[model samples]
Target: MRNIRIGDYLVEKQLITQEQLENALAVQRESKGTKKFGEVIVELGYLSEVKFAQALAGKLHVPYVDLSNFDIDGEAVRKVPETLAKKYTIIAINIKGKRLTVATDDPYNFNILEDVKVMTGMDTDPVFATRTAINKAIGKFYSMQNVDSVLEGVQAFSDMNNAEDDEESKDRVESAPIVKLATTIVENSYRADATDIHIEPFKTYTRIRIRVNGDLVELMNVANVVHNALTTRLKLISGMNIAEKRVPQDGRFTQVVDGTTLDVRVSS
Candidate 1:
């Protein structure tokens, strides 16, 4: 699957006529083969990776995914061997029920789908992604096991705070838990390259989601009590009036993470 270039895929799928491929190939051959077929074709304004990814989605009848900022699940990642994942340019992203969701650059390869199913003993749902994306995902997921564990622990801080509803003590009533939760949520989202961190209040609880890879994925859920405090903290940090909950307000604040400054907007 690693060698299955987009040019062959386009030709095989009839998205690119053979004459077009042959012409592109001729250009490459004439250049002393210094250029790739897809490269020459793209340079000639015939195709692009983004357009090709869209076309591939149509050809395979599968959803095309942008893997940028996609947080790989650690448990799901451990289900498949890293060697197999790298060789096929595939990433095991999620597991739910009896289904294992795998993202890869080659969605047309039915063999890869079947192999993962047999190997993991879970039904494999193949998601199409760019080759560069698949490679990056695989590397990121396998490279830092310790960092992943720390993130999970940080997430637990919020959850542990929520479970103390019956305490009603100074600790539970204090802003420390909510502040810690808010800080953790922001830092985690920043690390994951999230476009926005959504803090939504739901009836008796709260749902925290982050925009990553153009998709909204749930990060955590905590008690509404915790969310209230967290919301106030966010408003204050963003320079919004924290007491005015009924009226919608928007403000932004800047933070420096790893030497890069980022602006975070808050609204309600």
Candidate 2:
């Protein structure tokens, strides 16, 4: 027996009308195999993203995961580095013996599954998730690892401040750990396609939030001690006046990540 196509399955399940599926198929063909049928369906407003993902899970006979409320294991996340996870749009959800289970937006991508298996040295099991959920989870979990490093850098910076004069301390503010933390924030924001990044300072800690899909999500928080250094580093790069605290400032800078230049607008 021949396997039923996704569009036919969707029509059979009453998720999308036959006319909508025909239109989606036409658009998909026009893309020269560049776009997936489900993507075309969602883009054309034939179905919601979540519903398409659920239907895809059923069609593929794979479990569908709602990452928004799911509790993720940190160890599984660690097994797959942030860079690799982002590259493939896959997140490690569980690991048992030599098998690694991951949540992915595209379960049919056998190449990615094979690459992950080779990289992790385990058999790969993929579950279905919406692309939006996978991206949010990556931003939420991977960025947490960087938060710990940023805190440690804050303590080391404090120690250096005690031993150095004002002039020398100004130079040390560009220390390695803090610099990486600052750059990582920008990179993550760019990767998430965020429209804005908010760094809010409070009495005891500083909050970092990014605007994704028109929603402001808190990325992470760090100690108040690192706030000054972090702001200074960002200001220097953006050409803002680091010495002037009372006045509002606006500036723009270009960052190169993965050979792609991104224009960053800063307002303080």
Candidate 3:
């Protein structure tokens, strides 16, 4: 979909009440005329500058620019090796017959694209998106690829480490419950590709936090009290008393990523 402004989009999406929007609009019309929603929102105190930026970003459908995208010039991608491109998660999004559309928050992504053109002899077009939007889209693309399933990938990793079979590892596959939970989190995380897992105290709030390359790229506030259930389940699996939370605890478990099992530590 083409980019749309977040305030207008949210109003259209029914995410904010019409009255609230009207108030914001009224302030904007009075204080600033013809300015973008972001600027006006910040001036009128409808939202904090950071939040306004974030919302405006939602409207812009671009990830917030950061050091990662800024560091690589898009023009250089034209000469960058395809092997390196894939390894680096560098890709052309809108590839047509002869021309490819590259979406990135970084202007430098275009430089990279230019480098790729010289190396592979492919025509490329550079497009810009917010870091958040690009990461969200990329995560979806990778999930569709399904390079590895969490359980199978973890088991392979364990064997690679020559880790002997233990009760936990042996029953890992058999315990459909734990596997299912881990798989859901990992899959959802990959889909959103969020940086952190937001475990809030809300009853039905399941927010997935993804930070790609060191920025908070996506936040999926899923409306289902999945956190309570998942946290409880995790506590039980880790041999912690589910009913107790007065004391802070630390524990960890292993899961697979990219055909390798990696340890995922839990902290409260």
> Against the unseen true structure, what C-alpha lDDT does each candidate score?
0.72, 0.82, 0.52
lDDT of model 2, residue 138:
80
Off by over 4 Å in 3: 1-91, 108-110, 118-120, 143-146, 149-184, 187-233, 236-268
RMSD of 1: 10.0
**Candidate of highest TM-score:** 2
Residues 1-268, model 2: lDDT tens digits: 2399989999999999999988999999999999988889999998999999999899888999998768788888888878889999889988888888899988889988998887888898898999878877787678767767766776677665542232324666688867877887887777666889999989777899999999999877776667777888888889988888789999888987544678888888
lDDT of 3 by residue, 9-108 (tens): 7577665556767777787777657765555555666566545545544555555443223433343433434454444345455445666555543334
TM-score of every candidate relative to the true structure: 0.44, 0.67, 0.35
**Which lDDT value does model 3 have at 166?**
22
lDDT of 3 at 267: 70
- Cα-based lDDT at residue 219, candidate 1: 78
Query: Candidate 3's error at 64, in angstroms?
Result: 14
- Ten residues in a row with the worst lDDT in model 3? 161-170
The model with the greater TM-score, 1 or 2, is 2
The lDDT-based order of candidates, best leading, equals 2, 1, 3
Pairs in clash, predicted candidate 1 = none
Better of 2 and 3 by TM-score: 2
Best by lDDT: 2
For each candidate, C-alpha RMSD in Å? 10.0, 5.5, 14.8
